[model samples]
Target: MPASPHPDPFTGWLRDHAAPLTHLDPEAPLDDLEPLRDLIGDARVVAIGEHSHFIDEFIRLRRRLLRFLVERCGLTVLAFEYGFSEGFPLDAWAQGQGTDDDLEGHLGETVPVGVDDPLRWIRRHNAAATRPVRFAGIDIPAAGGSLLPALTPVADYLRDIDPETLPAIEQAMRIAASFAGTSAASAAPAWARLPAADQDALTAALTRLLIRFRAVEPLYVSRGDRRDYDLALRRLEGACQADYGFRAMAGLFAGNGLTADTSARDVYMAESVLWHLERSGPGSRIVLAAHNAHIQKAPIRPARTQVPGPDRIRLQSTFLHTPGLDAFDGILHTPAATVARDLEEGKTP
Candidate 1:
């Protein structure tokens, strides 16, 4: 059958550009990846994305590439799609401040816990390196339901620096606490049950808390340390964004656009990455680990006839054009059968 004439011209084109990576030893040092240095020359943030989680091959490939980035490329940070608040402890553990058990307990709370090998590799690498590589979580800390976890650090910082702002923080915490549950499914109903007046009040309080945090930044920095203040501020920002996202989810049935919520989350995640870059100083390279959908340099388009109408909302690209950042889709290839099936069905593979 001559392989059915190679199916399409793009297959030939891909063959021309694609190198056989299967020959590379999974346990070997990634000297073969040295060619990537030219392509990634001096980019501060290089995002490597996977199609799905929990696949051993994908995890191993990413781990090898990340080791190359860390050892050969001088990459200093490895940021995950996990929440910023939850990542702190992991980061601390990575930097050799905590025990392996502590790190395992923290990872148990996040999605990456399912794939333990790569994370264990990172922890070991960090422990042995003279200049430890840091771990960062860039998403909102609401994976376990409620945005309340993101607010704790901010509230604690406020208690020490500006006690007066505690009331607003407490109010936001109360609102978040009202929706406490194991998953979004269980918590969303609680959020939906809240009166519009209470929702508005919670939003107002959160907004006010942010404003107060910014207004008192100089004083707070002077009273404590600048790093602590900045950390607290980031946590508060995550809390605010998570709250907004949850509110949008609650309104999903009401025709309130969800794209904006998704865009906001991605932007917040990008901002968190940038924040780490700024803190790390110049010439610091970061390896960002995220789902391909969240890191791709393509615009998210809504379906024409989708609910709430595309015109009423705005969509944006994820991390394609951030200054000094390079986005790479790390998915090697789809199974040939899957691609053929998708093509026959007129669907995207």
Candidate 2:
């Protein structure tokens, strides 16, 4: 019954290097990586995601950080969480053309971005970096509820594991479930495995858990169906399977009208690391904007340390009480006007 030997490589390093690395704090005001300057030279990349209550805070923080990227870091692309059903012209979109309005209203009527927005801001800064930031939603299939059960493979795997690893794994699965519900229908089998009787039990348990997490805002739940719970777990796992790091913010569920105990923020930082490794170089540069929770440091052990499969990307992310709006080489929060419209239309609250 001795505590499990530290099963994670990064965890060991983090514990050993516990003295706050003078450079890790994202909010530091250095225009350059003066402390860990050599670690993230021109080739390295920095990705940040945010969940904020104020739209102005989101917009101002995001824009300032992004402006820094253009002036200091050779930032290349600006990606978004939502996409369009029909792919539109990136040039026109970037130029603030007719498509500037959000046709779907998922983000808002003014489109989550605008010509004067960060998208255009980055373009104005590095017009030559015009890679025509790809609109990937069109390529991704429309989401359906049928895929909820497809998450069982992961849940069953967690169910058979020990307690120490179970929470991290379960949390990861929840993050994956959230996204799986939005992706293709191939994820159904995994969801089918959760005991129908325990579904409510699990949801109720998670609802209590969420009560403590929603303070930072941006995380929410629309409904309390066991199926959505199943899907949320699967989405976390799916994102992890795809190499994205997952992190959950507590209490996000209750604020959005779902079980507070079970709400979380799904994240993928390792993917950003890998993506940065691939895209950054001496001359080329990239900047990413995402939730503050995604980049916060944690004491997480590797997924493979206790479970099977190659070491699933693991990181114990520190829960940030506030979003990292100004910490990036460049940053942009989702605009409030757009978020308001989505809430009004009942698309998302």
Identify the candidate with maximal lDDT: 1
Cα deviation in Å at residue 330, candidate 2?
13
Model 2, 268-324: lDDT tens digits are 233323433343344444454544434544322333233122222212233333222
Output the worst ten-in-a-row residue range by lDDT, candidate 1: 306-315
**Model 1 regions more than 4 Å off:** 2-7, 23-26, 29-35, 113-116, 181-186, 302-331, 334-349
**What is candidate 1's CA lDDT for residue 168?**
88
Error of 2 at 275 (Å): 4.3
Model 2 local distance difference test score: 0.36
lDDT of all predictions: 0.69, 0.36
| TM-score against native, each model | 0.80, 0.36
Q: What is candidate 1's CA lDDT for residue 160?
A: 89
- 23 Cα displacement, candidate 2 (Å): 25
lDDT of 1 by residue, 1-349 (tens): 4678546554555556555554334579576677677766777888877555444555667777788888888888888877788778777777677676776676553443223555667788876687778888888775536677688888888898989888888888887888775445566678779888878888899889888889878888999999998998898888778777767776676786665564677888999999998988667788998766577664544323211211211112233222111223322542321222223444221
